[model samples]
Target chain A: MKVKVGMMSFAHLHADSYAHCLLNNPRAEFVGIADHDLRRAQQKAEQHGVQAFDSYESLLASDVQAVIICSENVKHAPLAQMAAAAGKHILCEKPLMTRLEDGQAMLTAARGAGVQLFTAFPCRFSPAFQQLRAMVQAGEIGELLAMRGTNRGVNPGGWFNDPELAGGGAMMDHTVHVADLMRLLTGQEIVEVYAETNNLMYHGNFDDVAMLTLTFEQGIFATLDSSWSRPRTFPTWGDVTLTVYGTRGVIEMDMFAQYLRHYDDRAGRIRQVFWGDNIDALMIDEFLRAVAGEPATTLATGEDGYKAAAVAIAGYESIRRGEPVKV
Target chain B: MPYFSGNGLSDTCPRRAGNLSSVVNLLTEDAMVKVGIVGLGTMGRQHAEAYRQMPDVQLSVVYDRHMDRAEAFAQEFGATVAHDLSEFLKGCEIVDICTPTYRHTEYALAAIQAGKAVVCEKPLARTLQECEQIVEAVHRHNALLMPAHVLRFFPEYRTAHQLVKAGALGTVAAVRMRRGGDFPRTKSDWYADFEKSGGIIMDLIIHDLDWVRWTLGEVERVYAKSLTFRHLEHLDYTLVTLRLRSGTIAHIEGTWCDPGGFRVSFEICGDAGMLEYDSQQMVALRVARRAEAGQAGGVEVPESPAVENPYYRELRHFIDCYRAGQSPEITVEDGMEAVRLTLAAIESARTGKVVKF
Candidate 1:
């Protein structure tokens, strides 16, 4: 039987993409969506041709075997806990939760309830990244020495700009993706983080530009530019680029560069029409497979999410203390 | 003209007996400014080539502690060799010092003390103290000195600077610059000695550091990481994050680990738009040759032809400033500041902490 999956909320911008993935994945049954704001839920549900539940609790009470927690950064913990309590597997968003204690609590709830808690890090499913990982594993680039990554994007000015809801700013929102990728590629944990954050673009309280230097456990170092520095008129959202330097060779990967550049005078801007694999759908397929009792080796677990988020959390602390902090 | 010292021809001038005619020709070219080059290394050779291309600048004299190397260079460039430091100083009105990091302060101080305009290679000196010494000598003697921060002369970087100055990208938010290549193979491999060259952060990323300070404003703080401490053989890499006083964050990466050859790239993002340039993407020609059966392969060199070489432009600009008796765009103070910033970055990398200016 197909694994039945629902979405907990439409509060995140990725909720629409996840909803579309669920509807299109052949091995999963797309269930309804639930949100605190019924109108927003209803709008997304109707647009995706799915049912809209009035509340998250009602959605957890349904027959869905799993639920993707697509709520705001601050609400990920509670939603995942509720889903875990209802015996449903959970696929929480990028940051498993904003706070360390909340992430630990969510992991504990899932483990005690015997349900899987996967973190949504779709960049792991990128084909280019997959090839990069395989090559690195195969010793294409010999003993890894250093790495540089960037996940810069245009500012998504909504609840993301609200520090309380988003937990932090560009450092919090964008650091996790590349952080997770680094973990997956190196199989090492980030031990220390030094960061510089500024909001020069918008001059707001939330930072729109962040630069981080991360030190790994084995003495390897990497620098990450996790900034919302792309302008509104940029061709695409931004870029996910990683250049890994090893003893033997160097590999550069631009995850979303397989696109046609389209300049439209009507829209008064240039746009990138992507022709790459559906990374979100690939992630959802892995989630469903894990839900169906198959091994999902590539899926980002709750611990991976916590570790990546810890890097960003320590980044903020480093910025506060004006020094490098241990992660 | 007091610094000219009569076409620099003296009894000590080491012009070969067979090359007397060339020496006479060099002395008779009164319209040409006599230029002397010190150190026969890669940068020294590049400066000689640039001076050779300038019709109004005569490659008058050459000097190196190794007399054989200086003799060979002087013969090829149609110039006389100077065996003595004081005689070399007297031979040319402009002294281009392209020695290693440790010797920059020595030559620059000597040239400035002699009242000759000086064009010294980047990293004006090895340390802040040395850079300050050169700056002080320039002030004490009222001498003209220009640090050869050649990135300011590259057309691509110049365009980016101009665009930002013209507000093409409104309210710059961030900048990223990268430069790297294989470990340099020099005559002495002095670049491998961190004490002498200060690793990649000092010798390499100082280019971007100066460019960023020029385009952005003063740096408030810096955090950096590098493999210089690892003591790896023939490899070094560093990444530095700078917080500009104008609130812009700049990340600069410098590497000596890339085996695929040299690459330079930068991205500037602002409120209005973004500008990106990658040297690998701007290749106009590439040549690849197959390796012999038992030999390792040769590296494919990609060439991007420019209207004028940046080194030529930099030397030309310095010469023009010397002729006009005006301070150069890159003053001795600016070069000292670049050294200060680079030293700060090196400190941050070693201490693993944020260094505030």
Candidate 2:
């Protein structure tokens, strides 16, 4: 059964790119698109060769089984609720919900509608992450131990700058994927978090840099760094790698950068380097397979997204109190 | 002829003991490989000098922001000066980025794009994403990037890594590394600012993160406590605790506030052995254990002057990688991991809390 997919909007910068993936996907049929902004929608539609509709209702009612909501961060939960109520499976862009209750509300709606709700936290599909997970599960590495990971990037202002629209800046948008990956790979619920988030990078906007230290249920201590404040020229899409120290062996996977190669011809020479994560295509492919009901790969379930939301919100909560939050 | 065939092991034939010249003789092959320096700042110059007059390699050229510096470096090393970025790159097959943190990406990217192999200083990039972009560029262009986690190439760290990898310490039970030093004061006004340099933890302690991760694997969580006081006043000093996916615990105490002096050391305690490493102290393996007959557990030490300068080894590895079209020892991905850990440390520091890995 082919999963017919429709674009909910083109409000986010990466909306068109996500639509392009669907457009090229075999298992998922690219239906049509809907956005409140007609001109922008039409422009995106024309660019992607998909039909554009002035109203979301028209687009939602089209013969599509699911909708990938590439809408604003704030609208995610509300729109997800609506799409779910309409019996449509939802694939929404992340930070799940800026607020914990909103994430729960959407989760409730999806559960009540008896449909699947998939949140995008693509790092879980990175090749390095896959290898890490394999090592952890297979016990090739040994007893679970303390580890550290980082995912920092330069600011992505635009709508992300507006607190109301994007919920939080880098703290909200960036931490979700990493938080989700932690729970998925380690199988440990974060029990406590001491974190600090600030806007140390882009000239005193909302805080876009975040540092989080975590104590998991198993007493596995770890740290997750997610900032939109990375200095511009540091190579490889902001790094995300986990260093897993086990009883038997230690494994380090630069989920995004182990396969980095570049040509340095300073001395008439070409150089090759491996970077991190060879899983963007694989992740997208996995998403399609999950949508197609292919044994349901462990994705960012509403639960997973919800956990990230809870922890992230709690991180903010702790930040406000200048204290640590025990989960 | 390069004698690059080191599987890093004991072959039942014990060579001469505790001698630098003998060590060099034992290690080198017949040919003196040509090497070049890119981004001729302090590191570029140091690496150039490190490689100059070496039995293993010859200094080919030096490239820098200032053509005069490049020329001066060339004069000093009897090498060539890259008149421009393109020309300099064309003359040297080996490129090193000692550029400021911000310029790291551009210089590295340009070098890689020009078909040269590279060795970059830490943090890969300010962001994991930038590292990923560079990594992608490397893949698309077929280039090699060896992010210099020079500590890994150093004799002490190399030995420690071997013991850990060989299970010298049964299974790694815990790790703690401490590094404290006064900030350079003025790499730039940007270094004074936390944004560009990523503060002391990202800029300095990150050395530990790279080495620890290199020794361990992935971290499951991080609980960090940090402050910005004393040395550099505004620069941060941090203590980060890491839990790996394998349940091994680790901690790092880092500071840009070392008013006393520079301190660099790490201790790895496994089930079997407890090992320690400090550059200022001992450059060889120092393991301590419970001694019999009321003699407290004392360090079983290896003799010193293990003077294998890892920075030079790192650059040589980069050169070998570039010349051979092989994978580098410390890759961009490794840099990315270090970047990610740096960000996570910042996150933990910000919230004054523990963070999920």
Best by lDDT: 1
- The fnat of each candidate, in order, is 0.81, 0.05
Please provide, for model 1 over A1-327, each residue's C-alpha lDDT reduced to its tens digit, 9 standing for 90 to 100: 999988888888998898888888889888898889999889988999988998888888889999998888999998888899999999999877778999999999999999999999999999999999999999998999999999999999999999999999999999999999999999999999999888878888899999999999998899999999988888999889999999888998999999999999999988999999999999999999999999998999999999999899999999899889899
Task: Give the 10-residue window scoring lowest on summed lDDT in candidate 1 chain A.
Answer: A94-103
Q: What lDDT is obtained when candidate 1 is compared to the true structure? A: 0.88
Q: Candidate 1's residue-wise lDDT over B186-272, tens digit each?
A: 767888898899889999999999999999879999988898888999889999999988888899999888887789999998878
Clashes of 2: 121
Stretches of candidate 2 off by over 4 Å are A258-280, B1-357
Model 1 docking grade: medium
DockQ of each candidate, alpha-carbon based: 0.71, 0.03
Q: Mind giving the per-residue lDDT tens digits that candidate 2 earns over A143-228?
A: 66556666666566688888888887777777777778778878889988766654434535576656677768966667676666
Q: Give the per-residue Cα lDDT of candidate 1 at A70.
A: 83
Error of 2 at B309 (Å): 9.0
